[model samples]
Target: MQDILYNLMSTEFENPWKTIRSRPIYDNPWIAVREEDVLKPNGAPGIYGVVSFKNKAIGIVPVDSEGYTYLVGQFRYTLNEYSWEIPEGGGPMNEAPLETAKRELEEETGLHAATWSELGRIHTSNSVTDEEGFLFLATDLTPGPSNPEDTEQLIIKRVSLKDAVAMVMRGEITDSLSIAGLLKAFMIVSSY
Candidate 1:
């Protein structure tokens, strides 16, 4: 059954969409937008707009020895609201995601981890943007003064890991990276 499924999957997977032409629609330091003329799967002509991220989105869930985790709260300009999320930021594509995660965790939350493990990678918004997010589990934390970016006005909160998961369930945390990281961390922590 495994071989059969693998054969079917390997054989059946092929890109049906074809790009006729793609033109740059917009570009900034963080993102680039492109408009593409394409042939749909049904062989019909269509237009697809795609946003390409210049960096990988990195998120860190810092779990301390006391079963507590830290959250960062800041006002999101794009959402025009306050958001509570895991320590997250964008890292240049040339850099390692783990290194970026470490830097982001310390910058936003003032916490450093002695050990790090990957939780998972997620596509932040696949439908419109090609922004990929990397999530990590940071353990054995040491607290220090945070050094947030000049544009950031952040609040740090330490909560039990269970409460952090509950916040995700209750929709208090809406950021995709935070939701993904927290849930993954919860599952891993529960197993130990």
Candidate 2:
């Protein structure tokens, strides 16, 4: 099965569309918007707008010995809504993802983990953005003081891993990275 899947993916499929030209539409420290002129798969000419992220998104699910995990609640300006999610932040392109996860966990929840394992990687909003994301499972936690950024007004919560999974099922946690990380963590813990 693995070989079949690998062969399928490794097979080079010719790109269906042809790019005519591209130009920058907007630019910022966090993201850049670009417009591309392309010939569609069906030979129609069209324009495509893509948002490129300057940093990789990192999420961490920090579990204590008691089977509990930490969550962070904050108001998302873009969504204009309050969101509950696992500790997450943008990792600079030059920095390691695990290091960013550790910083985010400590800054948002005041917890530091001695052990870390990668959970998964995802491409968030692949249709419109080039934002890549990574999730980590952190354990052996120790408490410390939180140092959130001035731009962040965050609330911290601790809940059982089971309850976190329930939140995901109930659609209470809509953040993609959080849902993915929590579900993976649940599976990892359940195997123990």
Candidate 3:
């Protein structure tokens, strides 16, 4: 078992897919879509479509001293539904994710944290999009007025961390970043 584990750990894998030709399918300020002619891992020829993001996604779970966390409610245009999620936004590639997280938290909920710890990172949608997300747990929060972007009409709610976790389990919180960030924060908070 140890040998097998060691061998697996030491194994180096090479890229299996080979790209032959590529061209842009679409482009916008936020994302660019490209289609590629490629050879699959099995050496079969195929076409792959990839969506490249112009920024990294940053998500923040802001929990106050009473173990309450904030959720941002907004109508997601793409999803065509109302969504409740943690404070999150896109940060440019050149900016530090922590700075983005702080900005998003303040912009959406008007909360600033004196303490911040990384929860984890996630690939938002690896199968099609090259969007990466950074998750953070923000604590020791100070509340002020929010300054949301013109495009955002947000509603903020404060709930206990346990309630937030319950929302995740009940599927009330459907945003990918929120689900991942809430569950992670719950686990981390519960362990202490």
Q: What is the C-alpha lDDT of each candidate?
A: 0.95, 0.95, 0.96
- Which ten contiguous residues of candidate 3 have the minimum total lDDT? 103-112
Q: Give the TM-score of candidate 3.
A: 0.95
Q: Number of the top candidate by TM-score? A: 3
Q: Give the C-alpha lDDT of model 1.
A: 0.95
Instruction: Report the Cα lDDT for residue 165, model 2.
Output: 98
Q: Candidate 3's residue-wise lDDT over 1-192, tens digit each?
A: 999999999999899999999999999999999999999999999999999999999999998999999999999999999999999999999999999998999889999899999999999989999899999999999989899999999999999999999999999999999999999999999898
Better of 1 and 2 by lDDT: 2
> What does the lDDT read for residue 180 in candidate 3?
96
Q: Candidate 3, after superposition: displacement of residue 48 in Å?
A: 0.3
Q: Candidate 1, which ten residues in sequence have the lowest lDDT sum? A: 5-14
Off by over 4 Å in 1: 1-12
Residues 69-176, model 2: lDDT tens digits: 999999999999999999999999999999999999999999989999999899988989999999999999999999999999999999999999999999999999
The list of candidate 2 runs beyond 4 A from truth reads 1-10
